[model samples]
Target chain A: MAYSDKVLDHYNNPRNVGSLDKADQNVGTGIVGAPECGDVMKLQIKVNDATGIIDEAKFKTFGCGSAIASSSLATEWLKGKTVDEAMAIKNTDIVNELSLPPVKIHCSVLAEDAIKAAINDYKAKGSTRKPAAGVEA
Target chain B: MRYYEALGLEPRLALDAGDLQKRFYDRSRQWHPDRFSTRPAAEQRTALEMTALINDAFRTLRDPAARAEYVLSENGLEASAQRGKDVPADLLEEVLELNMALEEADGAQVARSLGQFESMLAGVDGQLAGLFAAWDAAPSAGRLEPVRAALNRRKYIANLVRDARKTLETARET
Candidate 1:
């Protein structure tokens, strides 16, 4: 039942806790929930279109300390990473960094899912804005 | 299923409370340790085990939510096995928005949201009643799926209501 120091630290002072404009073409928002625990997490990333790097990340989570910490850490790792690099981020990395216990492993998975969902949303928006010019024509 | 077996009832979702109480008491008396005290040590052990199982069965089967969960687990649809993949996106969005509003809600706003959440809980419970009957009439995976989804939604809303009440109490105390 005891949380690791890292989890407590992030929990008490979660970084990048806020929201991004979902309507912005460059911003991707991911909202996910855990029915088992009644937890909801929202993670958003603003990608720098010119460089394809994530310049901003934010999260709002309503759940246990572990879930809040997981999403907080996720946003921190998300910023400054290119889209491809962000996609490679895994839940295990968050688990190791946060020292989450076995029961809290699902929190990390939720964070990873949020990251992927946000990226997918951003990519989906991009594909819609610009059609496949050469292939269709 | 074992709980149902322990109480000598079929594994069904709906049960009369009075009948269940009677069955529990009847089984408890039959397995009372006093009756087995004069018997062999093996018989005494069996009595002790039966007493525990009967108590557990009564406790679980009395609550509709817990009873549904028991049936789900027996059929390989355990709640813990669910990862929110089945949660509709619109529900998640609504939950997120409500949480955001709650963070900044004043006393009046909190009370309003509490009323809304309570009614939502009522709606979910009503849905559950219909689902339980549907499953009892004809048990099938298709029928159980909606029951599980409704249970998940109920759990989420229940948590919201609990937290909102706590927040309101704290606000009043301060």
Candidate 2:
């Protein structure tokens, strides 16, 4: 079947297609896969430490056009959004945007899941950091 | 259950091929549409359905990998395309690199990568064999988790091999 125009557009011009520094405390990396299709996706978000807003997002996906498009669009929507707002981005919206068929719906699901995983990683790191010992100048 | 019952056998992963063939032949003969011509229309329809089911069951059960997947789904541990999540991290990284190679490599490079992927697939299969034995011995949901995970790994490796071969073929055709 022919892909939607949006899907093709994103596939040909995938935005933010790279990896962030995963070891950075301010960056959260999400890695996910679909073993049945041999697809893998890695999404990362860099969040400002004090403001809780995402400053940048990047993704690397190993799959079909729909998967690449899905993650590419995911990163595009992530930048400049608050973590809470990003969490609200649903797979169905992506499906509608890309006009993904029922078969490709899982691709969108993978994208949404990657977003959540990245946010969780970011939160986990914050929680694990040592608290401030005292007031500073 | 339907397939095994149709063939007068138990649900088993290690079915004897000769026995399965004999059973399939016998059932096909009994349910053949020609034999039901003289019967009522309803009987003919039922016979047609049964014949179709028997054929499908035999085809699925004959393949070892398909049979394993069938057994897993039957036991509520379905190995669906949608259920692929939480793959081990190191393997995910390897898959990403392999995908990049497949995109940029020529026929010779693809062949080399294909060999490496095939070996990885074989290793996963060997691990699956051990897991299958463990599950067959005990047959519990807990024991099935590792088997399911192994199957996922096998599926990924198998798909990569298919992709690499396709890329090689396409390059050759050009």
Docking quality category of candidate 2 according to DockQ thresholds = medium
Query: Per-prediction DockQ scores?
Result: 0.69, 0.61
lDDT of 2 by residue, A34-92 (tens): 76676889999999866779999999998899999999999999999999999999999
Q: Each candidate's TM vs. the true structure?
A: 0.95, 0.87
Weakest 10 consecutive residues of candidate 2 chain B by summed lDDT:
B77-86
Best by lDDT: 1
Can you list the residue pairs that collide in candidate 1?
none
- Poorly placed runs, candidate 2 (over 4 Å): A127-137, B81-85, B104-106
Chain B TM-score by candidate, in order shown: 0.95, 0.86
